[model samples]
Each structure stands twice: as structure tokens, then as C-alpha cells.
Target: MGFADTIPARLGNLSFRISLDMSNNSFHGYLPKEMSHLRQLKLDLSRNLLIGQILSALSNCSRLESLDLSYNQFSGYIPKQGIGNLTMLKKLYHIYLTWNNFSGAILASISNCSKLAAISLGHNKFSGQIPNSIISLCHNKFSGQISNSIGNLRCLAVIDLSANNLTSEFSSSELGLFTSPNRLHIFKNCGLKGNIPDSIGNLSNLVILGLGDNSWTGSIPTTIAEINLSSSFLRGPLAPEMGELKDLESLDLSNNQFSGKILSSIWRLESLDHLSLANNSLQESISDNL
Candidate 1:
């Protein structure tokens, strides 16, 4: 661990810099605005004790491609003129600002970064409707319905908005917009309700799905694999067609209101290694064929 103190202002005077990594240090105090003078391609100051608002002057780093300032005590809204100005940098592809005290609405200007592939902004105090451009935003205080505009990001392959205060019913149209073949969708504990859209069957490329700890009301989507819908309002017979998901390895429908005889076809799932149907109105015993 490095000694805690303000970063030296003189270090920013260096020219032709390509990268600077000062992460996992004890550095505290506000980030120096002068550091933006270095035209670096990547800058990482994460895992530090840095505090105070982010300086808008940092936007001067026109060549910066990646910026990571996570795991710090940095608070206040991400300045629209500050970090938002980085949209002009066409090469910027990644931004990591998770585990901070940053609050307020995520700037819509972020959508201008067309080349961006990944961004992590979880574990913060940010609140408000998510920007249509963002793909990953979890563990925040955001409320309101998830905008249908999110479906416009055709290339988005991951969506994690878990642990928020949102109280909106999951929309089928919003769910069907995700056409990405290899996607991981997680919306656990976001206060979501309503039936699980049958349109979910369209996500043929979905690899992992987590929608647990909400108030969902519907039968299990028979086509899904590696699903977790535990602790919800879901009721009805466990779909026998679930046997069609030959690739399913984990299925958890516990703590629900389902009532019916265990389907005999479930024995056909050759790849399933984990199964939980506890706390339901299920009847009958496991077949002796096992």
C-alpha cells in the first residue's frame, strides 16, 4: 500500500504518455486536475481512497481509451462537462466507476460513445431511469420502469440491473428487444412483477438467466437454460416441455406457489445436475426409475 497523500501535480507535465496505472494504492484526497494533461491511452486509479468530485479538466485527455476510478470515496454527480466530455474521444471503449459514492442520473451523452463495448457502474448511489445506451447497471438506487429504448442497443450482450429499488412490471416488448445470441440477463430483486414473457423463447443465444427474488407471476419459460426464478409469485404446473431444454444444468423454482404432480418428462433432462422445487404445492414422490 502506498502512503496516503495528494498526488503530485508535477507528474502530469510528462508528455507522450500512453498509460498510467496507480491502482491498489493508499492515495487519498481529490484527483488532481493536472493529471489530465498527459495524453494517455489508459488511466487506472481504482482501489484507492481518493475523495471529492471528479475534475472536469480530465476530459482534456483526448487520446484516452479507458478510464477506471472505481473503489473510491468519490462522491457527487459525474460532471456532465467533465466525464461526459470524453464522448468526443472516439477511441474510448471502457469505463469502470463501480464501488464509489457517485450519485445522480447517468448522463445521456454517454450514448455518443459508439465504440464502447463494456461499462461497469454498479455499487453506487446513482438514482433515476437508466440511460438507454448503458448495458450494465446493478446494485444502485435507481427507480422507475426500465426504458424500452434499451432494446435499441442491438450489440448489447449483458444486462445486470439487480438490487435496485425499481418497481416496474417487466415488459414483454422490452424483453424481446434483446436479440443478442450470447447474453447474460440478470434482474434479481429489482421489484419487477408481471408474467415472464413467452417472448423470452426468442433469446436462443441466452446463456444464463437470473430473475429471482422478485414478484414475478407466470409459468416457467420452458425454453430457458440455467435459470433461477426462486422466491417469486410464479404459479401453475411446471411445464413438461421444460425437458426440451436439453442444455439445462441448473433449475431453481423454489419458494413459489406451483402446484401439480412432478412431470415425468423432467427425467429426460440428461444434463441437469441441480434441481430445486422446495416450498411449493407439488405432490407425488420421485419416480423409482432414478
Candidate 2:
């Protein structure tokens, strides 16, 4: 398309650029090689039709701190050669490559960016186990267990491995070490199986936890509340310990094999807005103590 032929030549003439945001446009075709001309601190080209490989020429932007190419049609193995150069700058921190057509194993070269804090590659076609260096990963075709190596990311704060094909146990001891105050962990619609680890309670700062539509078999952890586990194959008595979440807002445990009396504790969540316990084998009886 003419887009591939014309835009870069025009963009190159602009000077003194600190950031460039050209997102949410219809700009299609390959990223122009002349993109390297602008030494922007950040570049956002998300939610567009940009396609083909990411240009290695972008590595020339030595001062670049963030590069977001999400929600696009960009495909092929992530331009590791291009990205490898960018990481060497030690300044790039956030790299968002979500909702693209990119595939293949995540490159180990990403680890070279030791200063990296957030790397969101969700909703891609990438296969294979997640790299140990990753702190934030999600929504790909990744299989196998959630690696215990993720515990190594001391600065880790968020993980959203939802809607993938992962099947295995979570590393309780490793995941328990996360101490971020605003942590959000989601692992819904995957093939994960095993007990909801007690160690999950350690994440006191958790605001959102999604574990729905999996094969997990266990009683809901009392330490967990305001969460979603609908359609997951969980079975066991719903623990009365759920009343501890005075701040609980939403709870969904429908379409499971849970067999027990609905605890009065659940009826007491003052912050509860949405509650679902449908399609379960629970005994129907209500405490009049409301």
C-alpha cells in the first residue's frame, strides 16, 4: 500500500521529538524503516492495521523508554533482532505487543533488558513455555505449567495468563512471594488443575483474581473473595471463611459440582454487588438472619 511508501518520508522531517503517538489509525503495511529517524522517548502505534516485521531500525532511538504496538496485525516471530537492540539501551521498560498475529517462542534476548518492568504480550499466537525473565505475561497459546521461575521477578506485580491452553499447578511458594500492593493475577479459561493454594492468601493487596473456567478441584479458599470461578470444575464445601472479605464485591461459582449448604457468611458481604451460585449441587435453604 501507499502507506508503506509515503508516511516515513514525511515523518522524518519533523524534529525535536520526545514522543510520538500514532495509534488507533488505519495505517497499514510495514513499519517504515525511517522510523529510526525520530529519537522519541516513547512511541505508541497501537490499535492499528500495521503489519509485517517490526523494523530493527527502531533500535536507533536510544532514548526510547516505551514502545506499544498492541492490537495490530503485526505478525511473524517478534522482531528479536530489532528488539534485542532496543533492550541493550537499558532504558526501554514497557513493551506491549498484545493482540497481534506474532508467533514462535519468546526470545531469551528479552532478559537482557534487566531494567524492564512491564512486558505485556497477551493475545498473540506465541507458543511454548513463558520465559523465566518475564514479569508480566498473558493470553497467548502457551502450554505447560506456570513456571516456578516466575518467582524470580522480584519486582513483579501483575500476571494475566488468562484464555490460554496452560495446564498444570501454580507454584505456591513462588507466587506467594509477590509483595506488590496493587497486584492483579488472572488465570481464567485455561486448563489449570490443582488446589487453590493457601499461599495465595499472601497477596493481601490483590484487587482482582480470575480463575474461572478451568479444571481446578478444591474448596474455594476462604482467603479469596470477590473473585470468579464460574464453569471451573471445582468441588468441595464452600468454606464459611468467605465472610472474611468484608470488602468483597463480586463472586461467581456457577456451573460447578460444589455440594454443600450455602454459608450464611456469603449472605453478609455488604459490598457484594453480583453473586452467582447457579448450576451447582448445593442444598437450597436460606437463613432468615438477613
Candidate 3:
């Protein structure tokens, strides 16, 4: 039998992961609804001129784990059926739907993927408050404030939630995860204010803590013996207790109201790398046992 320009209907009989990839071949029209019968399958029809709404009938693949329908002239929202039978496939991970015109906030449906390690819904028109449960270390504004329970993810390594429309107070307690090896960067303009919490000292394993460009005021927490709090609007006198952080390599308290003599406790840091107390009104009198 010679190869024909059209997809052979007989190709469906493979009964196992049959990839009929004729995408972008100028194949105009609806996909054969019978294509859903393929068992143990992965379907890819992206980068095509295929036009029409995604079919909801493809939910028949009880064993289907992955699907790709990106980069096409397709219009309207994404098909939700491809995710209907995820109970059986324990190995399912990774789903990308980039360069499409999908819309709506699906906080309820995608939560079923409780075991997902990484998820991306970028380049689409998704909005509203991102669910607090589905996101532990990182999240964006689907709506609402940052979840108070976001501090539960103990295994999270890297977090990035810099750009969004959120409002709340970021406390040193939220940086509790720094006790582990993971680093954190929170550049929120979310009206965060008040004194620095002493809980940050618990992060013995933290490498970097980024809390710049916020409205935090008051005394620096003594627990944060090591960190850079420049341009954070951090005011008040430096507490002598902060020098207890022996692990601190650098301290940046420039442009703050830190006044009074330096605490005797600050001299305890054997691992201190740099200490910046510049541009502050302090009654500091440095002396040594000469």
C-alpha cells in the first residue's frame, strides 16, 4: 500500500500510543473523534492551522497522561477532558500549553494534580487569585492576598513571586523556611510594614534572603544576625543582640535611624565578612583593649 496524503484511518488500530502527527500539514477540519480510543497514548497536534474549539470528547482515554495542542491557529479555551482520568497514571508530570489563546481561572480543576512538582500556565490569559494550597513556595495573583499557610512547604528550594498585584505584610516569620538550604526572593510592594520578626534567625541553612523595596519600618530583628536590608526603609536603632548570628557574613543597615553605642554582642561574630553602619545617626564609640 502506497502512502496517501490523508491520514490512514487504519492507523488507529495500533492500539498503543499511536501518533498520527499530521499537524501543520494543512489538515483542516475536526480530529476524528474515534482517535480518543487509543489506549496508553500521548497526543500532539500543535503548530497546525487547525481551527475550532478543543473537543471535550477526548476524555475517553482512561490511561492518557500527557497532551500537547500548542502553537496553532486554534481559538478559544483549552480542553479540560485530557485531565479527566489522572487517577491511574501515577507517573504523569509536565504539561505545556504555550502560545495559545486559552482563558479563564482554573484554580479548582488543576488542584487534582496534588503530586505535581512543577507547573506552568504562562502566555495565556489567566487571572484571579492563585490558589493558596496549590502554591506553597511560589504563586501569582489569580486574586487575593498571599496565603498565610504558604510557609508550610518545607522542601521548596527556590521561590519567585516578584511580579503581581498582591497586598499584605511580609514578616520575618514567613522567612522561616530559610532554616533549610533553600533561598528566597520576595520583592513585594504589598504594604509590608512593622518590626522585623526574630524568627528569621531560625533559618540557619538560608543562603540569601531578598526583601528589598518594601515599607518595613522599626528595629531590625536581632535574629537576622546576617543579611542586607538596604533601601528597605528599615528604621530604628540596631539591637546589640543581632551580633549573635555567627553565620552572618555581611550586614547592610545603611540609611537607617540606628543610633547608640554598638552592642557588645556584635563582636561575637567570628564569621562576619562585612559590616556597614554608614549614614546613620549613632552615638557609636569604638574602642579595643589596647
Q: Which candidate should be chosen as best, given lDDT against the real structure? A: 1
**Alpha-carbon shift of residue 88 in model 2 (angstroms):** 1.3
- Decide which is better by lDDT, 1 or 3: 1
Instruction: Give TM-scores for every candidate, taking all chains together and pairing residue i with residue i.
Output: 0.91, 0.88, 0.53
lDDT of 1 by residue, 222-244 (tens): 66679999998788888877768
True-structure lDDT of candidate 1: 0.81
lDDT of 3 by residue, 42-155 (tens): 666656555565556555655555566556544555456644234433334434454555565544455445454333444555557654333222233344566654454444
Worst 10 residues of 3 by lDDT: 132-141
Please give, for residues 206-289, the per-residue lDDT of candidate 2 as tens digits: 777788988887666555446998988877788767767788888888999888788787787888888888999999566484
Each model's lDDT:
0.81, 0.75, 0.54
**Candidates sorted on lDDT, descending:** 1, 2, 3
Instruction: Predict model 3's lDDT versus the native.
Output: 0.54
